[model samples]
Target: MRAHHLAAAVLVAALWGFNFVAIDVGLDSLPPLLFVALRFVLAALPVAVLAPVYGPPAPWRYIAAIGLSMGFLQFGVLFVGMDVGVPGGLASLVLQTQAFFTAIFGFLVFGERPRPRQIAGMAVAFTGIALLGLDLESIAATALGLTLVVAAAAGWAVSNLLMKAARPRNTLHLMCWISLIAPVPLLALSAAVDGPAAMATALRGVTLETLGILVYVALFTTLVGFGIWAYLLRVYTAATVAPFSLLVPVFGMSFSALLLDEPFTALKLAAAVLVIVGLALNIGLVPGRIVPQRSART
Candidate 1:
């Protein structure tokens, strides 16, 4: 990759990494489900104006499924996990487990055999997650939070399979369409779970900071990040652009420690090393046969 392209890839990773902090900030003001509903609502706005430029890449059913799985299920569970007890940095690391889940699903669904390294990588990464579970000193991290985040990772893995099957030509267009599909169900769920009164209150009491966080996540993180990512994928091979995503957790943990005062225990540091090493192995950075590589999504 060229210097500028490398910078752009790193920029996307930074935006996505800081997004966990943004979500953690937003959750202080709004309920989790409601925050997600509002996010999708704002994110879908571009689809209305840019409908001519970015057409739907798949059938409505496929788009809807992607929306529900990727947009709603993954994010909904993620926000709730963060809101409940998961620290932003820890959540980011745990979410990388999605790659392993994706590999597992690929094997089961498409009969794509996992290489030996992939299996070993999965073992190493899950061991890191197990270590994370044992770390009791990490601030605000809980068993329920860890489980929900892992489930969210599985949801993300499901969306990856759906994306592969759909074979969308334009990722940004598909993202926009899915943005449209996610808000309705999210809003309904917000009303159901968060309560209609809380939803009303949250909207009525929205602060500038909260709105800024929403805009950052919707416009910068989701749209701009993916837009640049799609461009990089077009210009370079997936293998070339994909590895930079491993930097996300690096940024995530650093930002959380600096901004959110999230302390990294010895166990947490060891776990981070294991997970990143496993991810490196899984993505073919450490050698072995390369399979169909998937780009990391936030």
Candidate 2:
């Protein structure tokens, strides 16, 4: 990748990193699923305006599946897990499990095999999760929150598979379409689980702070952050672009510690290192850098 492209990737990483903090803040105002629902509502706006002019209708069935898995399930569980007092830093770290889940699901569904290094990396990552699990009771959220985050990662992996299956030409467009599909179902689920009374009370109590969080998450993180990511993936090899995404948790943990006053303990640091290393390996990258010929655009 060129210098400018690398810069864009870094920017995206930073925005996505801060996204955890935004979501954490938003949870103070909205219920988990309601917050997720609002985020998607804003996310779907561009599609509502642009789809008519830019293209035919989006792939509805596929986008709906993507929404169910990635938008509703992933974000819903993640919000809940974080709301239960999982520190944004650790939540960011644990969510890297999505890469492993993607690889496993890819193999099971499509017979795509991982290279030996990828397999080793996954084992190492699992070991890291095990290490964190040993200290599960030490964290404020406990094991349930951690488990929910892992389940959220699995939901992301499922979305990855759906995206792969759909083979959409423009991932950003797919994302916009999914945002449209996700919000209503998520809101419905939220009301069902949270109850009509609590939902009404929460909605009435929404403040500018909550709205600010929604705007940050939906516009900056989901839209612009992913807009840059899609651009990078299109212009560069996945190997080159993927590592930049790994920087997200580094920034996430740092910002969480600095801004939220969250503790960064030694054992947690070790676990973060393991997961980041595994993430690097899973992306098929080494420190020396391997730049492949850019493949034709999908």
Regions more than 4 Å wrong, model 1: 287-298
Model 2: per-residue Cα lDDT at residue 262: 76
Residue range with the least summed lDDT across 10 consecutive positions in model 2: 53-62
lDDT of 2 at 122: 96
Best by lDDT: 1
| Per-model root-mean-square deviation over C-alphas | 3.5, 1.8
Over 1-298, each residue of candidate 2 has an lDDT whose tens digit, in order, gives 6678778999998998899988878888889998899899999989867788765234678877888888766898899889876888788888889999999999999999998989989998888877887876564457888888988988889988999888887888788888887888888999899998998999899898888889999999988999899887888778767877788899899999899887888888888889988888888777766765565774
Worst 10 residues of 1 by lDDT: 289-298
**Which tens-of-lDDT digit does each residue in 67-176 have in candidate 1?**
99976769999999888889999898899989999999999999999999999999999999998888655645988888999999999999999999999878887888
Q: Taking the candidates one at a time, how many backbone clashes does each contain? A: 0, 0
For each candidate in turn, the TM-score is: 0.94, 0.95
